[model samples]
Target: MITKTFKSESTIQTLQLVQQELGADAIVVSMREVPAGPIWNPWKKSAVEVVAVSPNDEPQVRKPQPPMQMPPSLEVAEEIPEIEWDIPAKKKTAKLPPPIKLNLNPLSGQPAPVTETVRMTEPTAPSNDRYSPPALKKIQQQLTQQGVESSLIERLMELSAETLSPSTLADVEASKRSIVQLMGAELRVQKGAGAFVSNNVVAVVGASGSGKTSVIAKLALFFRQGLHKSVTWVCADTVRTGAIAEAKAYTSALGLDLKLVYTPQDLKEVFNGEQANDLFLVDTPGYNPCNEKQMIELGALISEMPSRCTYLVAPATTKEADLHQLSASLGVFNIDGLIITKLDETYTFGGIYNFARKSNTPLAYFTSGRETSRNLETADPMRLVSALFGKEWNK
Candidate 1:
């Protein structure tokens, strides 16, 4: 799909520009009021920002129609009998070089010293087993070793067998690697740390203990050092003990701006005042996805904002069911990407990989430890595949 943003003096003007640029079928994704300058700059006026989307530019594929049948016509060919006639035969002759005179005896004639010829041989390819063991069983074992679910493993192995021949699977290493690559071929990843500095607003949300505050801090550090930009830290988790304090400490140490918002109105005001900041990392209170009241509270705060990239953080150590439920419970918050936390806490990331596909969530970033501002890395396809396959190849 196609997406674009338009900013203007008012919502109507911004939308008019969006519809004009994107087309009549374009969809409105987000609309919000933003500051004309740094949020704290009193002279700056308020402006509106609008985001839109349209169908992808790709051409749709049309199915082919069956060919029409035609009437059959019969034809006959004539043949003639074969006859034999006298054939002439050719005499065989020896192929030899002209005779040369011998140096030792002037009268004697000798053929040139029998020519010595050397034959060249071609280089040989490395030999492989002519045939492999059963393809499905072998692949299933490898996928299990990588921690992929049993059901997915079975389906993948069957697809592998259909695409590959026994001889292709004979080279176990090459065959397995190809299958793993296929598994990661469609992994969708968003520009993680880099996007922080440029995006106007970003809210980090997830279940309690999912590391929302830590992720915000990590992103702040990345924005400051990695991207060489200033950051504004906002804490909307006033009800959570130690949440504001933890975020305050990180922002103070970095000499960045810190703001506290107890309500959506407070956040809107902060966004208007903090215009000078390159990025805004908002810390949200973690909730129990099973608690409907808590989920509504969390979703309410974000829904007030017109345009924000919402990141749902989840622990890497969590179970498949919990991950899916966490995403589903908070889906109302308009989640844009996923940030997987506590990678150092778990070795098997197959569930994370599998969950992304099952939920259709775009992976954002990964945190490896409890360190407030370190161990943050982008969610990369190669890295996920390398971690799963237990090797560093092609990462």
Candidate 2:
């Protein structure tokens, strides 16, 4: 038969090509899928390859020709002598023992339940300590060293276990991408830039030196310029040095108003003078979470505006232990979301990620540098996962 090969993006197309060239009588010999592009590129699309043969050239089977009788002289040349039979007797076969029988009747003369037998035969669930592939173990170690909590790392590894394979793991880039996708699934991000809105006073609170003011200034600029909303700055931090002057500098530049409130009663007056279509950005003094008096006063101030969006701003450099402590102490504010700042000042981001995940807080924004104009960004799941995996956030 005349043999030929045909290739196409699908099996149907390949079969059509084979039929067109070899006619309707063509026979398919074999078919398989192969990479359409270079083999090294795993993302390349696959093509179907088919081997076919034309029926017109199929080989014919010949009927066995009658065996020509051997010539009489050739057949008679080999004369042989007769031999005597000497056979032995057959050995006896061995038999197996009979099967044993058990009594199903109980001493009480009651019928046995069928469920007991099924329960005894049912299989058990697999152990939690499953065999982790070397690739997954390596990734777990990487996450651990990057300051991720053991619980969170274990969870991420468990979720990623199914996606790993010997071949896929060999490609380092592919493994990392898988990790990004896995961790991205766990990350929580705020939906939009609605943190600052009219009728809700936006407040920021955290431990001292957590870059609360920087975040506030960046947010003011964002709402004023980016969202094109009128921003009125409120500096509740009357005790901090240059707090008023700092608020003045930003407000004067943006041509917005600023208010200084030392007490919740004073804050109430500002609330009474609220204007239409105006965003209120309140900057509270750095709180000492352990200081019961300070926490109480912070809570009191937050209580003034029953409808407020309070963000707990924390530096990315904070340790996991301290993050938990802050969450416990400052949880009384009824925090609406989180704003992570000073991202450029630290290398490890696992602590924050674990904190947010465990506490179920939605990350609202990320601030890297001191530049109030360009450093603020809306929180993103991919960016957080990239940071966790040692990849550049921008990349």
Candidate 3:
């Protein structure tokens, strides 16, 4: 059996070469598109990579042969020697030596069996009496006393014996801790009431249904009331229904200025004429990742903004594949940080971990409940780690 991979822009050329080399017995295993050189030339667009397996060696065939007839011998067989035979070897009953006992004192110079070394190195099997649920519960209680959460302990206990073997349990815990370390912390509300006012210019961008509008409203209240910053809400979200009106209504109730911009030029004009004292918060349209036109349009608008883009993510409703796809599509825009919303709805923190890991984006804020701006917090790794393992923490 032979396997080979070939790359060629022309399918005919690749197939001809493969057939010539493998004697037409080659089977194509797979084909994949790969980037080639400059795109200015149509010939350099891409290449097809073909993987093939060939079996050219033939099995050896043997020639059939005729059997021969045997000649007869007429000699009488000679009597075989009568070997000495003792029934049951005369039933030997030799006296066995008495068992030797070793001295218990350490001073006794006696060598131990090599099996002792193996026993010391190899893992010992658990005794039948040691496989008690109560014993496991006691161990769980001890781990809880040492600050491990009871829920995690119980989950570990519920795992099958093979899954939760002593060695495997240690490995699982170590992996969990490593994941927590990488994810860092849970998002916490920004400290210092005046900090929100210092950086009043904000931009929110993310996939559809990620709660950007709700987050923008919460921030509006936070800055207008909590930080006492003059707020001007700008809407660049022309694609979604009720997006501009929703933002306008929310900001209007707080006596904040709301400007609706249809294009990047409109945005520049509005920002240029805006009051210096007012903090401008731009709301972008929620984009479907699959819509390349929308993404390109939104990217252009975001690029025009003076402030960096803060991507909003809804962890509770986001599936792993969707999150990854969303991240890839949004990568066109320079995503500065992330804001995770709808944390109150989901218990699994794996999505959060996976998102942060895949995107390499730092968590900026997290919204646990549908509270006003005060409920949003800066991300804290410890809180997230505790929450992921179902550990109770001081709220």
Top-scoring candidate (lDDT): 2
Candidate 1 per-residue C-alpha lDDT over 266-342 given as tens digits, one digit per residue, 9 for 90 to 100: 88788765555467778888788899898777777887676788888988789888999988887777778888888
Please write out the lDDT profile of model 2 over residues 207-322, one tens digit for every residue: 98998888888988888777777788889988888978888887787687899999999998998866676888899988887898988888888888888888899888999789
Q: 29 in model 1: Cα distance from truth in Å?
A: 78
Which has the better lDDT: candidate 1, or candidate 2?
2
CA error at residue 153 for candidate 1, angstroms: 1.8
Candidates by TM-score, descending order: 2, 1, 3
Worst 10 residues of 3 by lDDT: 111-120
TM-scores of the models, in the given order? 0.61, 0.64, 0.52
Among these predictions, the greatest TM-score belongs to: 2
TM-score attained by model 3: 0.52
